[model samples]
Target chain A: MKFKTDRDAKLGYWLILPTVVAISTLIFYPVFYNLWLSMQEVNMNPIQPNTFVGLAHFIDILTDLDFWISFRTSLIFTITTVIGTTVLGLAVALLLNRDFPGRSVIRGVILLPYVTPVISAVFGWKYLFNPVFGQANYFLVDILHLFPQHINWIESPAFAIYAVIIFNIWRNFPFAFLMILAELQSISASLYEAAEVDGASAWQKFKHITLPELKFVLGALVILRTIWNFYKFSEVYLLSASVNVLPVYIYEKAFASYDFGQAAAISAILFIFVLGFIMFYVKKVLEW
Target chain B: MVGKNTILKNIIFVVLLIILLTFVLLPFVTMLSSSFKPDNEQNTFPPQIMPENPTMEHYKGVLNPDIFPFLIYFKNSLLVAFLSAGIGIVISIFGSYSFARLEYTGRAAIQRGVLLVYMFGGVLLVIPLFQLITKLGLFDTRTSLIVTYVVQTLPVSLYMLGNYFRTVPESIEEAAIIDGCSRLEVIYRIVIPLSAPAIVSVFIYAFMIAWNEYLFASVFINSSQLRTLPLGLNQLFYTQHYVWGRMMAASILTAIPVIILFLSIERFITGGLTFGGVKE
Candidate 1:
């Protein structure tokens, strides 16, 4: 039944042709097309004359104070949040990795943050972090009596980023947990058995064997999460419209200011930053 | 043998589990309890984890036509999610099979290329995709979202299906071919049957991604009637501002289907995650 001639190769090409065409048309064309758009100034408003301004938008975006503020915010937000989620996720995964009481129910509950709609959580978080009547502050001031007056969680930029970070970590750690838990399960019981026979303590086995085995997954997840988190838009913006992150910054430029050119430029820059890691990840980590 | 260190280690694990479990459940408990309470009671001091007078009034409001186009939103979301899942799974099966099994020159190149396509962020394509859809007279059409969702969901589908297909022994396909099955027949009769679990897992995963998607649906589809649940819910939030009861009711309804499905298929989903993880 084997095709033993040149026709087989030809047939293979013919078979694959449609998929390649679809991929090119639906995927690659838009990517290359956006890259082109980023280069030229395309006025979103029909009234304004669309002009080609070379690299001006990128220059302007790079120099803009608001843009830099957001870039810094994104950096801090991405780093701290990712570290928080990964550490928390690993800890939980380790705890749940063993046979414990109520394990099945606890596992299901762990997925809540990942399962809940972003908008729902964002809204709930906003209400919880409300300066005046928010529940978190109420619990803090009224019950715990930690803070006397209200704390504006979403108003001040300093506190706003932290609130959003908390929300992000909460929503995302489950994803990390899922992956880490899967990895934890796969580690051979024999390795721990052998380690114990060799007089290795639990901490020593985890530190030497478990952590080392998890390195690639941890590296891959952190990279992927960082890229996703840095470009994370909806949660932060939805929580407070004023928080300036890269995605929101793009939204403002594209939608609010109606400056499609600048927005496209910023998008291109962010894509490059995000895509750099993606390419590395796909090439080295994912290894298709 | 029973040392202080062993006791200390056990205590640490207990403490960590307690904190983690609390973090996981508290917000949701708060949300669920608050949903049943009256509007004024949503922000009560000390935060009622258990409603004083638990009632279904908020649920009624959420289902009210004036509050939300609940039925319409539900129907639209169902249609969108089902359509995308169906379309995404079919296209990816073929595409991923070709990448996994069929041998030809440039196979590696194409695989890498598809993986690269996976990394391309949605934000970058938003403008052009909108323009293309508009030019195709699909602006504000469900078709626009459906077609665009394929682009978003395709990569993960391909990766999942491709990896699954690879794990399937080629000898089975060869034997099927020898039994006079055509290429198409071999796939339909053998491969598809063998990969049902993977296919189901991919469908559910892709559906969730499409189902929970908000930003694109919000941006691309403008008509309230055409809005998906996420968009519909957001619109409700915007208008009502802080009506916690109604919001939670809608949120709970929006989340119920997937949650129920996940709970039912918890074994399959976790199994898939484990499978995908090992390969990775």
Candidate 2:
């Protein structure tokens, strides 16, 4: 018995080796390599090696006005979108948790925006908010007459963040909904039954029972959403150029300005900041 | 009075359901409606919700080889998605089974490492990865995308699959082991058969990740012939004289299959999804 168990342990190591190697090389190594590249002036030519700059890139990033603006923009975007998705998801999860005809089908359809490609979803958003001929302005100006005229809501810097936030919430709420619904299902029916026996109303049950049960999942959801939203790229980038977030800023620095070193430094800084946040959040909030 | 109150409550539920459906589905409706509109009507002021005269001209244009090369991009996407997801699934199956079933030295440590792995994001890796790819002379090739993509979903795949694999009765594997079956044989012959649905679901999720991937595809794949769908569609959007109708047509075609595949596996997906932090 002992010998067989030993063999099993050996087999386990062999089976697990590939993933260990892949994550270390593919994910962790790039992160470290990025940190190294950050301190050097990246040379694009084949002949010359990158020269060490010793925190020059970091100094530049600290002083650059646009970097501060993008950083502030990302924080606001993350906070608004995370709150939007969590609230909408909680509302929908509570509403839809009840059994109904065609419930399964509705649940599946609700996931479409999240599952659909970012490129596809954003294209829909752009067309809906298009400046010249868009359904959004058509409804707001031509039909409802809320605004005096058509507005370039997604394109203009003034309103693009709102549009992006709304878009983010629309796509991401499904993930939160799915997770929260699962947790809701697992809450014993006996608890609800006991509440009702005490003459608890719907609002009372939600406030006293449901909210407490949902606390953990909601916290995890918010943290996960914040992390994902902070570094969000494709949807925001593809939708509007004017709504500058850090990822878009990094892309421009690396590709547009051909400043690979600065871009690398910014990415490293962003990762460290977010990593620090995750540590504090996981330790203090989740208490795991 | 009781009956009247019940009726009012039911009406509110039905009305709210309808409103929620409309909000959730307006994008799909617009995508479908615009794709059918003729090019001239696509940009019309106070744009028609339903096309006045629907046509197949946009779809036909998308499929035409001379114009978009959409088919080539589609094929490239399919190939990369299948190849990477296939490889990722195979590695994840073994790794997840080990983590879930077998007790090994250092198992707890690696599990925590996998959790920390969730903190790393694409923007952090893009420059270094681009440098690594260029150094390897794999630029403009699918290999660059495939290798990175395989590992990109590893932690999620592990979390999701490990959760599912834990439910399979260990006694069966023990019995197989006693009957002189190797661990590898037991995994294939018994464990895999039981977890097929979950395996397939995780696979499709990873496939969608690769298919919808745009950042690396945009940077690494410079040759038009090698462009994946996201990059290609984006290029089409920027191409001078862009037609809204044709672009919407491409978007519709790009999204529908993935959504349908996801719907089919919705049950397995939501179950596993609760634990794994989402990729997006």
Docking class of 1: acceptable
Kindly provide the TM-score of model 1 when superposed on the true structure, using C-alpha atoms: 0.91
True contacts kept of 2: 0.73
Please state the CAPRI-style docking class of candidate 2.
medium
lDDT (10s digit) by residue, model 1, range A1-288: 363345445655665565677678777887776666667787564344567778888889888898888888778888898899999889888878878688888888888788777766766677678787777788777778987777899877767887888898999888888888988899999999899999998789989999999997798788778877876777777777666888888877776776777877888888888878667877887675
| Model 1 steric clash pairs | none
lDDT measured at residue A80 in model 1 versus the true structure, 0 to 100: 93
The local lDDT score (0 to 100) that residue B51 gets in candidate 2 is 93
Mind giving the per-residue lDDT tens digits that candidate 1 earns over B1-280?
8999879988998888788777776667666887899877876765657788899988887777875687798889889988988888888887777777777779789878877764566667676565556667887889888877766777778887887888888889888877887777877888899999889877877677777787678668988899998888777766744488878777778887878766765677666343343110
Worst 10 residues of 1 chain B by lDDT: B271-280
Instruction: Give candidate 1 misplaced runs (Cα > 4 Å).
Output: A1-18, A45-49, A143-148, A197-202, A276-288, B1-12, B272-280
Tens digit per residue, CA lDDT, model 2, A5-80: 8877998899999999999888888888999999999997523699999899999999999999999999999999
Tens-place lDDT per residue, model 2, B8-55, is: 987888898898888788888888899999878888886778899999
On lDDT, the candidate that comes out on top is 2
